[model samples]
Target: MFKSRRPGLVRRLWRSRVVTESDGHSGKLHRHEQRSMTHTDTAPGLTGEAGDLTEGAEREDEEQPDDDRGAMCVPEHRGSRRGQESDSRTVTCCLFGEWDFRPRSSYWAARKDGAGPCQCAPRRGVLEEDLASTAHAFLKRLKERSLDALVKAVETKGGIPGECVMVPNTELRLGAHHISPYYLLCKLFRWGDLPLSARLKPLCHCQSFGAVDSAKVCCNPHHYSRLCGPESPPPPYSLSRSDEHKPLDTGTSIGSVTSGGHRSHWCSVAYWEQRTRVGRLYPAYEPSLSIFYDLPQGTGLCLHGHHRHGGSSSSSVQQIRSKIGFGIVLSRELDGVWVYNRSQHPVFVHSPTLDPPSARGLNVKRVMPGFSLKVFDYECSSWMAEHSVKPESQEGPWDPHSVRISFAKGWGPCYSRQFITSCPCWLEVLLNNHR
Candidate 1:
């Protein structure tokens, strides 16, 4: 399980190629191993372990010819979400053993860590949106146009990220954390494996003007073109400001989650941020070239840090508890600054004026080492108490504020003058002022 954290493991998984006959017996063995382990049980005894696995392997060997027969064929329901509309239709595969739909080696490692096999859950929202018709089609489009579109978009909107910002897989991530759209797009499009003809130019560039002018900038113009257009609006959700330790609900519609054995959902109260389900994207532009580049700088809105391209700047605020601390990261790449807790356990942020009981909390859990769960209780807790606002009376969704960024300068303390709700520059200044 710890191996998953190693960059080498990920690189190896990403580097594997499709097994073919040219490789002879070893290739056949590997293919058989992949097929057989896709979903075997992992309870204990050899039958539950090795024996069942072998039977599955044999079955796969028998089925290999059928796959070869239809090697060029496409599965019937490859990229769809048409039928299963109800909660009952949300099918979850039983916790599969390590081999479930993966090569034997992957199965062994995953089983050891107890990570459940990937399910066929109608694909996630971002994927569905990107591959609206088909994953293959989406890949084709990305290959055909995303790079050009990204280049053109960056030429227009300066917010485009460059080579410096890391893009993670196609999952929602926060600005304060590592991971960026560049990483996701490359993985999804198999950009790394493609020949030079298919490779897109790196988006990073030198600033044309500013004090840090010529400073290297991360820009994916194609995607950025769509972002700053009038069509894009702030995501329609906001989370409570404090750490509330809410349980994750298994049910959909209501936001809840599972941890260890306990399950808790965010409070039924529909806060603004939670309303915008993190990790989802809407088609943001009307596909254009000039419009993408002509847009003003700083028009790119923050995704409250929940964007595929985690933003670029580290937070200006850092509050240290004896054991834990919290900080906010702001990036011109994203609109809202991210409020992240450095604590292993849940740390609360609150308004100073509020009474203790009235404040809300944003409970956090460790998703990755150094990264904690981004959502929590609605209370304005201690984390925010040092800021100018009195903690007790600060009812959140946090109060809306504006930011003023200098196009030539990029971003600064003055950016807070504008009314962007997601960035916590005010809190940073408030704490700095007190200090």
Candidate 2:
């Protein structure tokens, strides 16, 4: 029946039937809802079928799990992604090649906290300021202990030959050799055996015939002239009656000058003596060996023993029964000192002057008992002019040129200040003066 009806009548009947069915289930649909439904119904026909769309959606859900598993397996990818995000915020600062600078929020806030990018630099500057202040205070205090005051104090309290005394609350430790103010006063003064204290007497100048007094006079000629009388006119006086009254030959040799004419005889003698004294105090060349010890020789030896009868027998017994300490054997051919530890215990040796060039900066050495160590090649000369002492003259062919050794309760180098108070032992070597 519907097919036989008119086509327009059939379409109108179908639309009326759909509208009537929708109105029976619920109220009339809103204009927006109706439009969305129309679009959904036509979208599949233009793009794909509903079954195809559902299948694609299910494949996408399954691929998400695989992607999550891959991300879990390779954590670096995730970290790189995070790093990229962080780097996007970072601003690099190009200073020097060594510096890695990044501007952080905290860096910008540093000005509020009174700090800089390099906080340690400011802290170090503060520390330096504190050190400078401390050093200034120390120097100020040191200036209070004047040399004149120190000399007066030492004169009031005489010191022993090897003893050392430190200024109270100071780092200055002065030895007996440094107890004189004259050395500090003289511009050309050098260290020598002739101490200023030995020339304190008024007559010491006259007794030494001006040789000793000239040093004092040369240092302060005007000051000494007032104390020891006017300087004697240069050697031979004029034959004139007025000049003859002056005893110009009092301190000089009579033969040094002739009565016929004036000569600088006393001045020449004085100059020679001064030069000799200086040469004796400081030699031009260094000796082959220098000996140093803390204890006296023959200290631990059994000199008066029953085995002292035969020379060979005594030597053999002494080797077996002698108490161990230290001994040295110096050979002229070797041009060095062979130091041995005679003690059963180990001994440590330290010689800044004698250390070998190949020692790789090592200065201290240890030696076992019955072992010998050679040191200081003969070719080496002393570069330390201030510490070197001239060799003393001795009457032996095999004797060393110079020897200086010190000892303490234990092993180590003995400082000059501690030499007296540290149970010190000493050894000295005297060599032929001609060398």
Candidate 3:
């Protein structure tokens, strides 16, 4: 939980991860000159995955076709506070902010078949290492064909049409066989524009489509709406609009947004990394191989970090020596965490209870930059191998602790990389701290 402390060097240290404000002087003037060169130009509206794009305004109900009129009636009435499960018709999807962290287990017996938890410290490697053969093959195929061909194949498989109805296979969820096509469809369709994907089981709304006679079904418009309604947008977010606003000038290095500016939009970010445990893996602490995915060739992806507030009270410089989490959204007030894509898209991650000791910790905080992040947790990694094929396929002695990020020029663009790899920027930050 974050609370404002007194303004001083101590405060600055806590906010170091956040982006700085422009003082409205030379820093501001210089940024004004290079603003165009820095921030990526945003595309306002383009054809997205499976549905019509809704601009700033809500879609008009009058425009619905007779066949689709019954769709989304419930979602229209439902407020934003509700979770994804509430709407039977919808599948929750997010780019960043929500992190599905593995529950750290007590050390388990190492598998004799060389089956689980490799005994290597920082045991795992990057997603790239695990899928290097697969991804490389893909690259070669892309070059053999035209970019259009590559885009088409990715679109067909990943579902880039309408609302991005299909999730692209990247290093993250690659081996996750539980992924359902209907679930993917629900994620792709816009709640406001189409029928909720038919995958939802418990048929709650048989009446909307007219239930057959003799089958007395309680038509739940509530559940029906989720099955056929407007797709919910990711969460909305706000950058701090207060006087604490610091502008990021051209050369003013990028940092976290929650540092001290006014709150902007309210979208949640979700992070999905392969779960693994310590040692007995490639470079341990690196994300599992399945986390990596080749981005839709031309598209760009960006990683936004939200930093946590140090503490409520201010202390002397010596007090500033403590370490808080890295570029992640930290809030003392709201249980919900949100992230903003540089392209202006917002994602919302649900954090029900803040008991880190309890099972209900916020999902997004799992990979905090400087907190107790274990490069390799052997117990959890073993569990992941059980689900993957050729579990021992990834061999040893590879670099696995880099953060790979891809940036491009579109709003809501999807980028996929493994978190296990140590990114240059993160390494630099670590180096600076040591210095």
TM-score of every candidate: 0.22, 0.20, 0.17
Candidate 1 residue runs with Cα over 4 Å from true position: 1-133, 143-435
Give per-residue CA lDDT, model 1, range 233-334, as digits (tens): 222222132211111111111122356654442111111121122333222121100101122332322323432234333322111111121221122111
Ranking by TM-score: 1, 2, 3
Error of 2 at 352 (Å): 5.6
Candidate 2 residues 183-225, lDDT tens each? 2221011111111221121111122122321322212110110
* Deviation of model 3 at 289, angstroms: 29
What are the clash counts of all predictions, listed in order? 84, 12, 108
RMSD over all Cα atoms, model 1: 23.0
Candidate whose lDDT is highest = 2
Off by over 4 Å in 3: 1-130, 141-326, 330-336, 339-435
lDDT of 3: 0.21
What is each predicted model's overall lDDT from 0 to 1?
A: 0.23, 0.24, 0.21
Choose 1 or 3, whichever is better by lDDT. 1
Error of 1 at 62 (Å): 41
